[model samples]
Target chain A: MKMHNFNSGPSILPQEVLNQAAEAVLNFNNIGLSLLEIGHRTSWFQDVLDESRSLIKELMQLGEEHEALYLHGGATTQFMQVPMNLLDDGETAAYCDNGIWGSKAIKEAKLFGNVNVVASSKDKNHTYINKGFEIPATSKYLHYTTNNTVEGTQWHALPETNVPLVADMSSDIFSRNMPFAKHSLIYAGAQKNMGAAGVTLVVVKKDVLGKIKRAIPPIMDYRIHIENGSLLNTPPVFAVYVSLLTLRWIKKEGGLAEMEKRAKERAEYLYNALDSLPLFVPTVNKEDRSFMNAVFVMQRPELEQPFLDECKKNGMVGVKGHRSVGGLRVSMYNAMPMDSVKAFVELMTEFNNKNL
Target chain B: MKMHNFNSGPSILPQEVLNQAAEAVLNFNNIGLSLLEIGHRTSWFQDVLDESRSLIKELMQLGEEHEALYLHGGATTQFMQVPMNLLDDGETAAYCDNGIWGSKAIKEAKLFGNVNVVASSKDKNHTYINKGFEIPATSKYLHYTTNNTVEGTQWHALPETNVPLVADMSSDIFSRNMPFAKHSLIYAGAQKNMGAAGVTLVVVKKDVLGKIKRAIPPIMDYRIHIENGSLLNTPPVFAVYVSLLTLRWIKKEGGLAEMEKRAKERAEYLYNALDSLPLFVPTVNKEDRSFMNAVFVMQRPELEQPFLDECKKNGMVGVKGHRSVGGLRVSMYNAMPMDSVKAFVELMTEFNNKNL
Candidate 1:
């Protein structure tokens, strides 16, 4: 049976990417060495490093002004590293806490400096983005998550802020093209829309680094990684290789514009199915619904199991929502095909008819 | 041509392990979904986590007294984390700086507490371990790297310390059995002998945590990860899975005792080949020669290129030594077959005859 993957992260990747990644792991760049075992310093691996970084720059359409670094420790590590590198000890950074990831970032940032919660959707259980709050002029930077994977809310537009913007696009990166110049720094863990789970991609304005006064640990220092070309130590080689493959796939599939169109079509189909059905209710506010993840609850609680079972029988996987949200979440990442979404929607309609 | 991989880390893995890992990435544990796209909270992933952790405990022969935690940020992060969790700001920790990794650990340790260098092999350009050194009885813990990957040295026996001992066994972990009980903490980056590059394996005595005066970051706090079952954040899921496969392979091929015997045999074969040849000279002290990585250099500089080319033609890869030590290093890690070692030895003999 053909499986439609809908897990939040370590999510779906294009088949071409997977095949290329597998081939490289078997024999990298025709080097007769597994990508897993090649020395990070070798020209073969360096090509991977350079190409992966270049692809991100190309995808974002960022020029020499932005530097892309493939760093370890995932997005969670960046939560602390961002403030440690950008904010002085007593300075303040603005954070828009739209969901769990945003709140976590704020928490880590507070370890290094004072965090001004410019806006928070926590009062409304993070079901929508709060747009009315003011950004402080004194803030060093403003941090926000582009998409909340758990809650299924996405920022369709950039937040208006005079301060330098830092976006954690972990769940929605590459799903669409955005105004890259609005953000001074953007980071994303590759598992969601990129490739694997271990590596975090960061695009920082080269001028913004080395401003903080703290003696940041070498691993936590962006300057160190960038200077060494992200090969200061042995990198997550396999993850980076897979990410490169995914990037190539994205380019072959007509880049982010086409990706956004396909993503929207998939998400709209699923959302429309939920809206028209009597047995399900969409969780997020209509205006704030995520194209990356569609969250919905069963109208009748008892029908939840049968609906999930029917989806599974139809070869849909990872439809179960995050434990915090307790419903169904269809993570339609960039690599998730329109056919998979149509299949899922068909299953949902069938289950709704039976249950209703 | 079959390539013999001798890269110190991101080293070679068993062919079967690679095949199995690739299969899992496509469809994990018979689930029709790609392992990459599976939800970690699902029973399927949880089972992988539990079994992987369990295998580590079993392979190490670690009893109920010890706890294992799989973490991110590699062993480098543990350098700071060890002191942050165990020593107060003003307290001192004893460190044995035998090579690069040990000195790095000492450097990171100084960030959290005062470090007393009990012994250092640096006086001899890190070519030999200092047999004579006194551990400070007043120090919080004694730290050392069990194997120096760069210098190609290994501790034949651990130093007897009154204080708690910590070992950075990144390069030699799981290659052989050692005194697990002798140390309060043992941390290893998983790339070398264990699995991939992103995950770090930490085995800490249960009683050693939560004594520091400083507020450690949640991710940096060893106790927090331990208490949370290393699920403090989403882990390097695929890396852990690969480690589990390697562990299973080790168990199936007879335990660590057999592994030690095989490693010794392989190292001896390669070392004998280098020693007997007039063209090559071993780099490390004979008594301290590493069983995992055998470092050597050409007796005459001009013979280096031809010898390296001949070895490359024989399908040996990554035998070129580290830049710090300009020579050749044949890292005979656990997965290296004795036949490959013999093949390398043959190449060495042919090159030696030509050079002489």
Candidate 2:
């Protein structure tokens, strides 16, 4: 059986990237040393660092005002560090509580300053992005999740706000064209549409920082990272190297425009199947449907087991839904080929035909 | 010429471990997916996580009273998070300002609570550990760096303090035996003597946490990590897997005792040559020398460039001194072979005969 991997985050990467990364691990750039063995300070690894940072700027078309930092600790750490560096005591920031990560980020933000729940999807089982509320002019920044990995919802268009924007594009970064100029900061954990876990990419507009009065911990300070060029400490070298290889793959495959096209095609095919199939139904609002993850459930709840069994029989892995939103979720990241999505739809169709 | 890697970290890894890790990057545990692709929650990776945690406990002889967590982020993150979880506001903790990392940790700890600098090596440019100072009885914990990476000094014996002891063992962990019950907590970045960069090994006595009154951020909370088995969020899977492979290598090569023996053997060989060879002098106090990193300076400043050139010609990399300490440093990590050190000594001997 041909396995179709859909493990969110620590998920699929381009085959070429995998092969190249594997080779580097054995002998980095033919230096007769494993990439794992080389120090980040070495010329071989410095090239990787410089290249990874530069590629992000090129892909997003970011300018001199923006600096890209490849940091360790994943996006989870960023939830706190972002506010720690940006939000001062008695200051206010607004956030949308649309999903698990969003709610968690809101919690961390409150620890630093007053965080306004400007919008929320909690009333609707987190199936939609809450866009009904207003962003306060006094808010230091308005934070939003560009894509919710668990809820299968994405903000196709960001809110037009005067307040500085900070977006966590963890699950959908590099999968589509980003309005790089609109946001003050865009951060992502390098797992979806990037590389492996352990690294976070924080692209920040330089001017938005240093206004807060708090003395930020040097490790967590974005300004220090911009000053030090993200070599604050020995970074997640293997993860960053893998990310660089992934960026190379993305550029080779026609960059974010092509990625967006493929992602849309995959989601459309899978989402259409979910709606039309006898025993299956799409879970989220169609307008807010995510290109990264398509979550659905069996209309006839009894068929859920058969659907899962059929998926397993076909070697479809990680299609299992998050425990919070139980049913099914198929992550179609940038690296997920159209053929894999087609195979997934076929499995769903066959399972529905037998069970319905 | 075969290269000799002595980079402090993100440094040399076991060759067999490197080969295995590289193979895993392509296909993990025969599951047709890259280790980079698998979800940390899946049984495949759950096994890796369980095995990694178990190996640490087994090697350290830790029992149920202690729990080991494999976390994302490097040791620098640990500098702040350690105090965030351990020290409450106004509660004092004792720390030794022994080196750069130590000074950094002290700075972060002070942000969370009152930090007493009970001892320091700064007066001597961090070449020696100040042993005469006493830990305050009211201090919640006593923290120290096990090795001064910048200055090439090691604490051969941990300070016997009535206060709870916590160690930052980033550079020397897994290379020798640890006093499992003597410390309240032990943490290490996995880049040295373990694996690649990005993962942190936090071994904590279960009871030591939760004593503080302040609400520690969930991500920074040691108790939460213990409760969730360090899966509070996505972990650095590749780094952790590599760590497991390295641990396996360590066990195969006779574990900590063998590592300690090899380290002694390498240090003795290099230190002997440093003393006997012309135009070279050891920089640090002989009593405080680190078995892992040896720092030495040219007796004659004019010979520095010629010596460095000779080293490069013989394929010695990362032997140049840190800019902060303008002297050569040879990091003889556990993965470093005795043969490499022998080769380095030969290069030194020949260079001295030709120049000095």
Candidate 3:
């Protein structure tokens, strides 16, 4: 059965990318060596890194002042690295406590320097994006999670700030067109919209670094990584290659414009269906809802498990919500087909009608 | 033609492991989704992490005191993480400077604490591992690289020390039977003898951690990783899965005892052939020579390029040495076949005859 995959992260990748990745593992470019066996410094893998970095910049339409790096350790590592490199001890950085990822980033930043949470939606269970927050001019940077995967909220507009914006666009990067160059630093874990779980994509403006007074560890320092071209050490080669394939796919499919179109189509259909169905209630403010992940609950809480079981029987998987707060979360990444969204809606309609 | 792989880290893995890895990427366990598309928290992936951890402890024959963690970033990350977790500010730690990896380790450790350079083989270009290095009793830990991949020297015996032992076994881990319980922590990048390139295997004794006074980042802290069972954040899912497959292959083929046996056989054959060939010169001391990577150079340096060209024409690849030091290095990890060694020796003989 060709099931509809809705896993939050390590989520859906284009079918062609998966095919090429599998073939590369067996015989990389017919060189008779597994992709896993090749050295990172070799020309073959270097081409991969080069193309990936180039594609990232080209897609974002960023210039030479900004650099793209495919680094090991996920976005969680960046949570600390961002502070260590840009914010020195006694310096303050502004953060928005939107949800889990935002809160975690603030916590890690606090360890390295003073963090002032300028805005928070915590009082509302992070169901909506906090706007009109005052940005402190003394802050070295203003940090926020552009998309909250758990809370099912996304910032549709870039937060207006001149404090050198740093955004964790882990769940929404490359899925829609945005003012990418406006931010000084943008990082996203590859598993969600970019590629796989091992590699992280970081685009940073070179001028923002090296101003901190603290001595940063070489591995944790962004300037050192950029100087070495993200090859300061052995990177996740397979992950980067997969990401390159994905970047190529995005280019072929007409770039971010096409991706955003598909995202809107999917989100509108699901949201429209949820609004019509009396048995279901969509979580989060409608305007602040995420285009990638849709979180919802049943009016009759007892029907939740049965509805999930039915969805499973009908070839739906990974529709279950996050364990931290469970209801139902249907993640529709860039690769998710509209047909799957339609099928899920049909299933929801049938279940709601039968239950009512 | 099937090339004989000798690339230094990100080296060859078993043929069967590659096949299985490729298959999983297409359809993991017939789950109708690519392994790259599933969430790391899924039971499917949790099982992989669990088995890999169990296999690591079982192979090392360690007790409950030690915990095995599969982490992101390679051994280079550990160079600083080891010191950050173990050594406090102004505290002294003993380190041996044998070759590239050890020297890098020493450089990173200096940022975290006072480092005591107990032994160095720099006078001889790291051709031999230093023995009888005086480890300070008051030091927080004694750190060393067990195998110098670039210099082709390996420590056959553990250093005698009362301080906790931290070993970077990135090149030689799982290829030999060591006193595993004696070391406070053992970390290896899974590119050589373990599995692939992205994930690192960290086996740490629980007792040595949490004693340091500095505030450690959650991602860099060993205790946090172990407590979360290496699921502190989304790990390199595909990398860990490949490692699990490789670990299973190792166990199925008779564990570390059999791996060591094969390694010794392959090393001895290549080393003996190098010793006999009048045109070739083995670089390292006979006793300190690494069983994993054998570095050598042509007596007539000009013939080196011709020999390498001949090797390439005859289905040999990655025989080139490290870029830092220009000489040939043949890396024979656990998965390297005895047949490859025999063929390489035969080629060396043919090249010597032609050149002489």
Candidate 4:
């Protein structure tokens, strides 16, 4: 079966990236060495680290005002590290709790200092992002999750804040074009739209670091990796290599503007299909639907299994929703082809006509 | 040209494992989906996680007395986490400063509590492991790095401490059959003897957890990972899979007993050859020479580059000494075939004859 992968992270990557990564693992750059065996300090792997960082800067249009770093640990680790570096003891940081990721960031920040939840969508079960929410001028920084993968909501606009802005763009980074200048720090786990799961991409305005009162471990310190060129320790070489390849793919496909256009189109196609169908209900507030992940529920609960079964039989994988909110979630990341979306819509239409 | 990888870490992995990993990245398990794109929450990946964790336990001979955790971050993170979870706010922990890793561990530990250096090889420039060292009886735990990758020294025996023993066995793990039960906590970064960088293997005694005064982050708490079965967050799935394959490879090739026997033979073969050669001088105390990484300097300083050139032309990689100590280091890890050692010895002999 020619399967269409819609799994939310560790999700679909460019086929070209996969091919290149496979070739490298077998014999990297005709060196007759497996990528797994290459020394991290060697020039070949160093090129990978350099180019990956460079590409991120280019793709995001980050200027001299920002510096990029590749660090181990994932987005979850960043939840604490962000505060540990940026906020001081007893200082306050503002967070907008729109979903699970936002709440997690808020929780971790509280461990370092006081956190004021500037706004929350918890009252509405996170079905809608509460825009026009206020950010306190007293806070050291304002934090938010740009996209909620689990809850299927994404911020359509940047929150206005006088304080330094920090965003965890883990699930939707590079899928759209956003104003990069508004944020002091932007971090994303590479597993979703980037490449693999081992490395996290952190872009910070260099001047924003070194203010915290706590002794941050070297691995946790963004400044250490930035100064050492992300080679302070043995990095996850293969993951960064694949990420570079994916970044190259994104560049070749006309950068983030094209990616955003394609993503919006795909999501619109799926949403249109969902609205036309009687059997399914798109779950999130329509205005806040995520272009990255589209969540829906079956109107007739008993029909859910058969619909999933038919989709699987027709070569769909990872469409099942997260356990916390179950139904269906088609994660249309950047690499998910338009044809795959069309096929999914076709399946939905056929199922609706036959069973409605 | 055929390259022989001997880069202490991110080092040699089995060709078969590499092939399998490469294939899965393209299309996993004939599922017509790339492993890079699959949902970690799915049954497919969960199976990999389960078997990998199980294999580590089986290989380490760890039963219910200890639980193995596939942790994020690296061994460096554990340097703080071990004390944070194990020691109270004011309690002191004993540490042996064998080399760089030991020093780093002690530095991170100090962030959480007091650290008492029971013994140190620093007085001798870290070229020898201090024997007959005593652990502080009043300390909460005793910590040591079993093998110094940089200085090329290994502990022949662990300290007899009544307190819980914590070993950073990052470099020498799986190279020998050590007393696994002697330590309550053993943490290793996977890049050295295991497979790749990114994932860390932590074996913690179940009873020793839940005693710290500080509030550890969810990712920092070993107990949370243990309870969640190491799936508290999306792990470095590919790295863990590679480590699992390496563990299986070790088991199939006659387990740790056979591995130890081969490691000893390879180390002895190289050391004996170095002893007979007049051009090179071994650095560490002969009694404390590491079986994993063998460090040596040129008898005449000018001959260093020539010797390195000769080795490189003969297909040796990663023989360059660490910058802290300028000399050659031949890391004879578990996966290094005996023929490679034989080849290295031959090169040494030829170079010695030319220099003399």
Candidate 5:
């Protein structure tokens, strides 16, 4: 069966990326050693690390002022480490409570210092990104999630903030055009559009560290990693290698500019079909709906399983919504082909005609 | 040219394991979706997670008291987190300073509480594990490194301590018989015998958590991971899958006993060659030499480059020692064949004769 992957994360990778990664697994760059077997310090593997860092900077148009680091301990770990490194004991960090990931970040930041939630969407079920939040003068940074993976909401524009902006772009990183230099730091877990699930990509301005009073744990501190070129200790070699390959694919496909164009096209196509189908209702607030993830619900609650089964019969995977919000979610990340989204829309339409 | 891999970590993988992982990268278990494309929550990937956790327990002969966790953030992260959960404010932790890794752990543990250096080998250049030091009665846990990659040292026996024994078994895990239940916790970075680099395997007793007065960051807290079955957040799917394959390979090759036998044979063959060679001098103390990593120096410093260049021409890789320790170190993990060791031994002999 030709299964069309709609998985949220650990999600779809391009066929060419898969082919290249598979080849590397057998024997990376014909070095007579599997990528799985090479040490991170080896010259060939160091080339991988170098290329990955270079590509991220090049794609984002980041200048020398910005330093990018590939690290272990996924984005969740970043939630605390970001605060642990940036926010001093007495200082506060402002945050926006938009969805699950943002809330988790807020929880972790509280452990380090005071967290001021300037805006929140939790009351009305997180259908929109809260806007026009005030950043406190005493705050060291303002943090937010660029896209809510579970709630299907994305910040289409960067929120204006004075104190250095930190965004968790885990699901939406490199998918669309990003105002790279505007933010102080961006951290993303590379499972969605990036690559496999082991590493996180962090881009930071080098000068921002060392201002804090408390001592940062060496492993968790951003200064040590940046100074050592992200090889302060052993990193996730295979994950980062796969991510580098994905970055190459992105560049070959015309970088994030083209990615944004294709993403917008996919979203419009599915959302139009959803708007026309009376049996299905898109769950997210349309204006704030995520281009990366399109969450929708059946008109009749009893028909959710049948619709899922019908889609399953046609080789659709991961159309099921998050358990917190019942329905279907089509995650159209950067690597997802237009044909897959077209097929999913057709499935939604055809299933509604038969069962509605 | 076919290279003989001897890198310390992210080192050699079993050929079958490589093939299996490569095939899955393209199409996992004939699921049509690439392993790189599948969601971690999917049944097949879930099966990979379950089997990996089970095998670690089954191999270690751990029963109801032991709970194995496959987590992100390598052993370095665990260096702080282990103490974060176990040690409290005003409490002290006893540490044995064997080598670089242990000292790194000591540095991280100090952030949490007072650390009493129970023993240290720094006086003798970390060539052997010091003994007969008293572990403090007020210490929360006694921490040590089971294998020192840089120093080429191993603790042949677990030290006698009244409190729980915590070990960083990053290099020598599953290669020899372990005192599984004797320790309260054991952690190893997966770049070694376990699999490729990404996840860290943590085996903890379920009831030992919540002993600390200071609050732990939820992501760093082992109790939450245990409660959620190690999937509190998205894990390193591909890394864990490869690790499961390695675990299966270990079982297919007759479990830990056979691993111990092969490890011993390889160590004896290399150590014997090192002892007999007049041109080479073993760097580690005879009583506590590592079976996994063999470190030795050329009898004359002037001949180091000539020997290294000669070995490079003859398909030897990673023969250079860590920069801090000036010599050659050959790391032969579980999947390293006795044949490769024999080939390297021959190379050492030929180089010695040619130069002399």
Candidate 6:
């Protein structure tokens, strides 16, 4: 049975990437040594680290001013590190709480400094993207989760901010064309669209660092990591290499433009099916719906389990929504084929006919 | 040509573990999805995480009072996290400076609280472990590196301390039987003897946490991670899985008792050969010489490159020493085979005969 993996994170990667990674594990580049055994400082693995960073810059179309780093501890670690490095004890940072991830990010930032939640859609159950948030001129930075993975909202437009922009683009990064240059710091966990689960991709402009007064630990400091070329300590070697393979695939398959086209195509197909079916209810404001993850529920909530069971019988994985949101979530990341989305919609159509 | 890998950390893993890891990457346990694609929250991965943690506790002979965690950011991250979670502001903690890793750990600990350098081998170029250093009763913990990777030193016996013992056992954990219950906390990066690079293994006594007065970030908080079962966020899924497989192998091969026997046999075989050869001189105090990494230098430094080149030509990898200490280093971790060490010693004997 061909399993359609909609896992959301540690999610579906390109088939070729999986094959290459597996081959490398056994014998890396015909070096007679497994990739698992290779030293990170050696040229064999250095090439991997170097190419991964370079590819991120190339894919984002960013310039030399922005540096890319592959760090461990994921985006969750970044929640505290971002504030620890950027926000001082007395200084304030603007934050937008649109969903679970956004709220969590805001909560972490508050520990290091004053966090001004300029916008929040929590009152409405985070179904929409809040706009026209006022950013204080004295704000150190405007922090936002560009794409809400749980609530399924994505910021299509760059926020108007004079201060440095720190965006957690964990879910929607590289899935679409964006004004990436406008942001001072852009971070994404690799599990979704990028690669695997162990590494986080951080793109930071050099000038934004060294502004804080508090002593930030070297491991948590962005300047130290960038200065060391993300080799301050032993990094997640295999994860970064898999990410490199993923980035290479992204480039070979026509870059973000093609990715964006495919993302829109898949999301539109699934969303159209969801909207057309009376048995399924697509949540979240339509305008702010995520291109990566589509959240929907059945008209009869009891039918949700039956539909998910139907999905499981037909080899659909991770169709069940996150625990916080008890509905179905069909994640259409960059690697998700349009054919898979079509099959899922067809399943939905059949389920809807029987339930209705 | 079969290359003998001896890179210090990110060293060799059991061949069967590598094969299994590669297989899992393609299709995990005959599931329709790649191991890389499976969600961590799913039962498929929960078993991996649970078994890995349980195996660590069982191997360490730890009871229910202790908890095992698989975290990201490597052992380097633990350098800061240990103090952040255990040492409070204005308090003091004891640290032993054995070598590079120990020095780094001391440096990070200072940021959190006053560090009392109970002992240091820096005066002697970190060639031997320091002894008889008084640890303060007021100290939060007595931190030391159980086995120094660089400069080739290992503490054969635990230091006498009333303070809770915190150990950075990155190089030698699971390699030898120790007073496992005596230590309050132990951490090792998985790259060395465990599995791959990415996840770190941390074993902590539950009672030691919540003693610090400082506001620890939730991400850096051990209690939070323990409470969440190391699933506070997305862990390095594949890395943890590999570690699990490696742990399973360790148990199947008679656990730490068998590992220690193999380690001693390989080390003694190589050390005996080095002693017999007049051309190559082993450094470090004989009493404190590490079983994991054997550091040596050529009698004539000029012949070092030629010897290295010769070894390279004959399929030897990572024979060059760390750049900080300019000499040759042969690492024999838990997974290192006696046959490979014997081959290396034979090569050394041949080189000595040709030169001297």
- Using TM-score as the measure, name the better of candidate 3 and candidate 4: 3
lDDT of 6 by residue, B240-329 (tens): 999999899999999999999999999999999999999999988999999999999999999999999988998888899998998999
Across all models, the iRMS values in order are 1.4, 1.3, 0.8, 1.1, 1.1, 0.7
**By DockQ, who's the top model here?**
6
Q: Which residue pairs show backbone clashes in model 4?
A: none
Better of 1 and 2 by lDDT: 2
Report the C-alpha displacement of residue A150, candidate 1, in angstroms: 1.0
For each candidate, give its TM-score against the true structure: 0.98, 0.98, 0.99, 0.99, 0.98, 0.99
Tens-place lDDT digits, model 4, residues A1-356: 68888888889888888999889889999888888888888898888887889899999898987998888888998998899899888999998999888988888888889999989999988889887877778889999999999999999988976899999999999998999867899999889988988988899998888877788877788888888999888788888888999899999999999999999999999999998898999989999999999989999999999999998899898888889878899999999999999999999999999998
lDDT of 6 by residue, A59-161 (tens): 9999989999989898999999899999999889999999898888998998989999999998988999988878888999999998888888889888887
Docking class of 2: medium
- Docking class for model 5 is high
Candidate 3 DockQ score? 0.88
Flag regions of model 6 displaced more than 4 Å: none
Interface RMSD of 2: 1.3
How good is the docking of model 3, by CAPRI class? high
RMSD for all candidates, in order, please. Answer: 1.4, 1.3, 0.8, 1.1, 1.2, 0.8
Q: What's the residue-level lDDT of A191 in candidate 4?
A: 95
DockQ of each: 0.65, 0.76, 0.88, 0.78, 0.82, 0.91
Report model 5's interface C-alpha RMSD after superposition on the true interface residues: 1.1
Instruction: Report lDDT (Cα) of residue A211, candidate 6.
Output: 88
The lDDT leader among the candidates is 3
Off by over 4 Å in 3: none
Worst lDDT 10-window in candidate 2 chain A? A127-136
Residue pairs in clash, model 1: A10-B36
